[model samples]
Target: MNAVNWGILATGRIAGTFAAALRELPDARLLAVGSRTAESAEAFAGENGAIRAYGGYADLMSDEDVDVIYIATPHPMHHANTIACLEHGKPVLCEKPMAINQREVREMVEVARQRDLFLMEAMWTRCLPVIRRVGEWIEEGKIGEVRMLSAAFGYRTGWDPAGRLLNPGLGGGALLDVGVYPVALAHMVFGGEPTGVDAAAHIGATGVDEQTAMTLTFAGGGLAQLACAVRTNLNQDARIDGTNGHIDIPIFWRASTATLHVEGEAATVINEPSGYHFEAAEVMDCLRAGRRQSSLMPLDETAAIAHTMDRVRSAIGLRYPMDA
Candidate 1:
């Protein structure tokens, strides 16, 4: 089979990370790059070894050689970008926080469904080996009846209103950027949408959430405590506690190791290299199998996570320009 050709729709940090990951995959090819400016597109294409560089997204979307497109634009652009890709007959892997709001995610999902094209949220944590192991442990009853989950992903960065992290216009905030990691993980473990979302946030001077705390209640009485921040430092660890014991995952969002702590047994550690490659591999595998959406990161779950995010944002009174 011919290698899968990828077109990246941005020149951002995450796009670069994905490009690097694709370089490690023998079946993945970086075929093209698109950016707002020709210079940016050319530079990214050159650095990432993409064969084509387009000054605008339309050009990339028209590339018949590209098998798929990765929407790595800012949070707000995901909806339009993914739709454009799907309309042009290209499958899409959109960045996390799929869109600024749930409504937008639903629309994107609808377009993909209507067109019978592949669409997936780039929730890379779901593809991590350590995270998969955590899932296995829960299924194996290593941690008896998961009752609670807690996760935090935060970092302190210099204040810059125009920067993506703090810019409301860019859909910047801790909740959309880092909070979604924990939120997605909670959905993965609980195997469904949250029954209730209670949240609070610190809205900074830039009018975006600087820090946010969330409590998600699942139908089966499972609960998740999630926190994220841009102006503060957090432990960046996660714990899944059950009736028997708990599973501890450090840097859970990009976890490379996890410890299974049972009540009477010795702690068992699961380890693997962390990279964006695993998610890329999954996308390629699904494509080869003629699947439209990933079973591991289903569109329904992505939409549910988006709905949960909307609830969290509403609870915090956080509104972006993209929110309608």
Candidate 2:
């Protein structure tokens, strides 16, 4: 109930964004930061107002003062990092694509349950108020029986074979990076795993997907068209088309506004904040109530999404080292 003491496990760009958001919450305190090196940890702590810095991740995890940890390490390290935190008796909020594949994700989930520790994949978009409103609209039948959807998230980045976005060794690709956003959105709207996954990708010189397009079929005849790319720009919008009406979300992943269009009625527009703080708030609320997993972003669903991604990768012949 007291101010939640937080520790961040990495000093990457995403970690910095999350750290800034935590600073805005009066009930949350940035207590410590851990990185591979002392200098980087100290630098992040100084910039982010953290009270302590640990040169090694193990040192931070062992700190009894920290209540929970936010794992912002690269995609390949999520499984190990999350398990370490749980083993240290700390809850975790791991960055999404929870792990490189389903097996790793399942392992992480199992460990959390075994340890009786709170663990959540940091799919921050799902915690946005606007997204919650969208869910309400669907449940209220404002969109009728949802039948089809389309979503795309993409941006062009200059080629750098060794950069995180292009390096296969780093578990880099459009699907894992930007594509997961659209995939997760579809899963939320459809309410379960897709029955079918068909996909195509342009494997770049670095042996990772630079662009990917997928068509997923859900039970009850629902369909979703999704795409992600790191070598091209996309509209970054989404549409959920139901039998009677549809909803349009612009920049849907970090969506702040959406419009509802019924077959024969005026359109309704809604807006809300879309910050990293919402997910952090969810973690704290769960910790306070003694819940081990987020109802909104359940561990089972997180693993299901990873399964779907595995299928997508198999379809496009994309493979990461962890997949083997």
Candidate 3:
């Protein structure tokens, strides 16, 4: 197909963002949208300029014109939704954290592989131009043998016991909600699972972690200190310290600028567009190329990150209702 026909499986905030980004790509068509209700689906389709709207996910799935589906459902629903799309012979770009745990991620990956269909965790940061530059800087030895990393992603959402950010049924918590950013960053820089993980969390009255801190020790002696909180405000900055100097990324998750500090040299700034279109472009390219997974954000990497999150949750004694 010269142009990819996209189907959005949710009408939430993230789904809107993905739909808007898809509009920025010339080879992408926002063909269909689906929601739990016909009204919601029609509203989203009208707002996003989709050609068709379905009251239920199955209806959208049955639309053979949709070449791929973007699963923007909450974390708790990722497994079922992704599997459903793959089973229908439709490729998927599921939002992260791909699922609530590693086991679910593995199952999703297995289905994609078995069906020879495309499936990717929509960790948009992994496809950002600034992040690609960071990778290149690391490879060029600009940060000479990275030794330490520090990052945090947090916002002052206050406390809402029944809200999605604190609801156990929705897999709500700072870790899964925002903490995945720093953890994914660590993996991108360090390149694998940590040798050891030490963590602690503040489980609020809602039975979800309001704030959590972790220290990941890599096999090569590198360390990453990361934190995420839902009830507090944080710098939301990231730094990579190396033998020579450090690289600082402000608002790291969706960073547009990164500054590299080399020993006794002036800081150099790298900048790029901080939009979701890069990931969408990557998805279209992968589809056109007939690839099942992204090299930059592989399924194995997605599962490994889920494993790391599981370890963090274990260390903090945070259990979701779905874990049982």
Q: Kindly indicate the candidate among 1 and 2 with the higher TM-score.
A: 2
Between candidates 1 and 3, name the one with more favorable lDDT. Answer: 3
Off by over 4 Å in 2: none
Q: Per-residue CA lDDT of candidate 1, range 109-157, in tens?
A: 9999999999999999999888888898988988899999999999998
Q: What ranges in model 1 sit over 4 Å off?
A: none
Backbone clash count for every predicted candidate, in the order shown: 0, 0, 0
lDDT of every model, 2 decimals: 0.93, 0.95, 0.94
lDDT per residue (tens digit) for residues 1-324 in model 3: 888899999999999999999999999999999999999999999999999999999999999999999999889999999999999999999998999999999999999999999999999999999999998898899979999999999998956778789998899899999999999999989989988999999998888999999999998899999999999999899999999989999999999999999999999998899889898889888998989999879999999999999999999999887777
lDDT of 2 by residue, 94-212 (tens): 99879999999999999999999999999999999999999989889998999999999999999899988999988899999989999999899999999999999999999999999
Superposing all C-alpha atoms, what RMSD in Å does each candidate have to the true structure? Answer: 1.0, 0.7, 0.9
Compute the lDDT for candidate 3: 0.94
Model 1 deviation from the true structure expressed as Cα RMSD, one decimal place: 1.0
Question: On a 0 to 100 scale, what is the lDDT of residue 183 in model 1?
Answer: 93
Name the weakest run of 10 consecutive residues (lDDT summed) in model 1. 315-324
